[model samples]
Target: MSSTASTATSPLGSGAPPGTERRWLTLAVLSVSLLLVGLDTTVLNVALPTLVSELGASTSQLQWIVDSYLLMSGSLVLFCGALADRLGRKWVFMAGLALFTAASVAAAYAGSVTALVVARGAMGVGEALIMPATLAIIGHVFPQGAERTKAIGIWSAAVGVGTVIGPMVGGWLLSGFWWGSVFLINLPIGLAGLAAAAFLVPNSRAREARRLDWSGAMLSVAAVASVLWAVIEGPDRGWTSSAVLLSFAAGALLLGAFVTWQRRSAAPMLPLRIFRHRALAVGDVLILAGAFALIGTLFVVVQYLQFVLDYSAGQTGLRLGPAALALLVAGPLAGVLLPRVGLRTVAAAGLALLLASAAVLGTTSPGDGYGRVLTAMVLLGAGAGFVITSTSDAIVGSLPDRDLGVGSATNTASIQLGAATGVAVSGSLLSDHYRSALAADPHSSDLPPDLLSSAQESLGTALAVARHLPGEAGPTFADAARGAFVDGLGPAMTTGVGVTALGIVAALVFAPSRTASAPRDKDAS
Candidate 1:
């Protein structure tokens, strides 16, 4: 085949470019689909307490319910991106939308923690397919320049918007209906996106037919799953236990093997050469760190508001509005500034803000009230907005046209992996510290062994046990539980500060000083 024949075809049929109106409309449809994917990332966060009461979920189970979706999506996105490149972006996107909608129904009616977790994993599969396709389609539809940058900024903002809005939506739903309503709400949105996408979204795929790297795909998934399993289960199962140790060892081996295979494969799932792009490398790290801070903080704060401060789900959602608003505002603003200011300044500033946010949150005490937390949320939101928008633009813009599918997938995988890690690491630290504090408390010594064991499982369980106790003992035990939870939040926030500080340093040192020049389409060379 001629080199010219090996480039991506125009998304619009018959080589007629889509009109500006159609291009923006396509962006709208893609953004809404992306919104659903992003919404799922945090929608379940507010519903976690309800799940504890409704499904009798342990802390580990709760982490699993959230991380399972993240894990599957993060791990499989590359493979799905490859499929979309070969088969059709539109086809994979529609299929994913349909599957995600169906999985939402299954998740809504799930009767047990195990069932709900399974349903969530299924949803993750759908997300893996949808996330990359949307970005790749955007790459196909929009030319690389200011126009594409603006579109990508809007696309990036949809993620932040979805994530921030999730708690509010879930809170409103949980206020009137069962927890299942959180999942069920996706039905109308998903169905509408699916139908609109069929007509509005144009089809595109790689002109060159390359062999898919199945071996690399499997190794990547297994490695991630093993590492995440160890992280999530380590607190409950004992970090030094044979199973945890084995998982860590296996993950390391699988990761090394994956790297070796990719280097040797005829058609690697992820081309190692891409990381040579400084902006792309730095962008992925910054994006990952930003996501870790934002999502991890949300995981802990939502629980803190509800479990400690006695806020209802609706109230908790309302309180979180400042962060969402800040993010909504900052995202577009970052886009407008990127071409003028350069990525280095914008990205470093964003990470600096996140570090400051984490530092503030680390000092939080039960008596600090909502004011302190509100300040932290605003910083977190604005920081994440700048980081996600600027870095997403950097990552996507750095790639050659041929690499857009897998490149976008890798970009998004960084996000999901970071968010998943945030939940696992934050929850583990919280659980381990809470358990230790509870064990050390004098109030815990008076409880029965079985009750003590249950209390050690989670703050919610501890509070429940305290409620059933007699007289002053009940209130004292509850106070201890609340104190322990507050103590646990410190370590998680401290970790975030450390991570953000590192990201700030990296961004300042490595990120490019100027906006991307133009699309070179290196494949043409």
Candidate 2:
């Protein structure tokens, strides 16, 4: 639908209206929406094993369970963001909440993996709408100052809170109920967000309401989805496979076309000039690097806890509390310090700490004490908290008010891509190294080729296979597999160390010394 051009008399005027004090209340309501989106990202992780058993889901199907949501959300975020700017942020946000709520109900009642995947894709559409709107509303409500910084900080903290509680809540629910309980929990929160947002979030839109960039939006979605599809499929299909290579080639061409179209278009959805700003450019890089490390670590470590340490889902969730607590404290603290210290200093410090954590994690072994791992996890969390908050402040604070929706979408998309790349790279490395370790073992020579192939596929499969082996062979095979898995972690984490090291240099060289002023467009909110 075409948006009406906003005028001074329109409720869509850019300024915070007379009741500016209600901004905090608006923030609270917006955060509720954000929390639900963030929680869904991780909550289903702990239930994957259950899903596999109950639904008889294959490996590819399991991957789809997660990727469907990310692919849709990440690909369409830019388009949805522009929709918010044109139509109205409040209208888009409420529509998103209603869609998300309905999708959650469908997901909870899904009878098969195919149905669940469809529901997840629907949820992603809702999430794309909600994410950019929340950030844009915060930018409008807080204006430019310490208050804006703090509000962004709170938003960052809410994500951290969601990350921590997702597994714990999933575990608790799964203990007594079925796997669907996790998705069912989102229902009430979505309803609450819809109700509160109507009363709290003010209607606002770009004053000019430029024509929609339909071609650019389609190309952007195609480029992002193609690249992400390659990343998700690359490890399993072999990086050099024809399909993977073709996907990468398609993504590159589409991306080039997108940039060219944006430069030439009369009205662009994302202005190419924004990348010229040091803060926006560097902040995005930092956010991407932090997400790569954080998600990659969680991907491997959760398996280590469950398969290697023999911890149950509940135990693994509980063990992650220290890291969550550290993140909870560090997010707000980083925001408070951003204006006092420069972005360069704050971001550099965060990267340095993250590099240290990666180095420590690389040194872990199968027999290492829990205390050491916990310490490393906490350090990782603290470093991530600092980087995420500071980078978000830099990105949002640097953009013009009119660009807020698409700009926020850009930030969110970078995060989703970083996460996809991290898991794929780390998983591939772990698989390669573990198989190599097993092949070189003298004991592995006794196993049949088929059993060996099964063991090489995944740690879970190896453990399952070991249990059925003859007598002493079972324990011996289990020990060798666990040891090989630990050996693989070292190489996997080495990649993280390199990624974070690059982030440190980027922060020092490219990030602005101080937060830049918001853009000076006449209609800027």
TM-scores of the models, in the order given: 0.95, 0.91
Q: How far is candidate 1 from the true structure (C-alpha RMSD, Å)?
A: 3.0
Q: Write the per-residue lDDT of candidate 2 for residues 405-487, one digit (tens) a residue.
A: 88887777666666656665666677678878977877788999999887776667777788999999998999899899899
The lDDT of model 2 is: 0.79
Per-candidate Cα lDDT values, in order, are 0.87, 0.79
Per-residue lDDT of candidate 1, residues 1-525 (tens digit): 232333334343342333323788899999998888888999999999999889999999999999999989998898888888888888999999999999999999999999999999999999999988888888777777888889999999999889988888889889999999999989999999989998889777776635788998899889999999999899999999999999999999999999999999888888888788778888889899988888888899899988998899999988888888999999999999999898999988888888888788778887888998899889988998899999989988887767777888888889999989988898899899999998999998989999999988888888899999999999999999999999998898887888888888888888888756435342211
**Can you list the residue pairs that collide in candidate 1?**
none
Candidate 1's TM-score reads 0.95
Report the Cα RMSD per candidate: 3.0, 3.7
Q: Give the TM-score of candidate 2.
A: 0.91
Clash counts per candidate, in order, are: 0, 0
Error of 1 at 144 (Å): 2.0
- Stretches off by above 4 angstroms in model 1 are 1-21, 518-525
Please state the error at residue 145 of candidate 2 in Å.
1.1
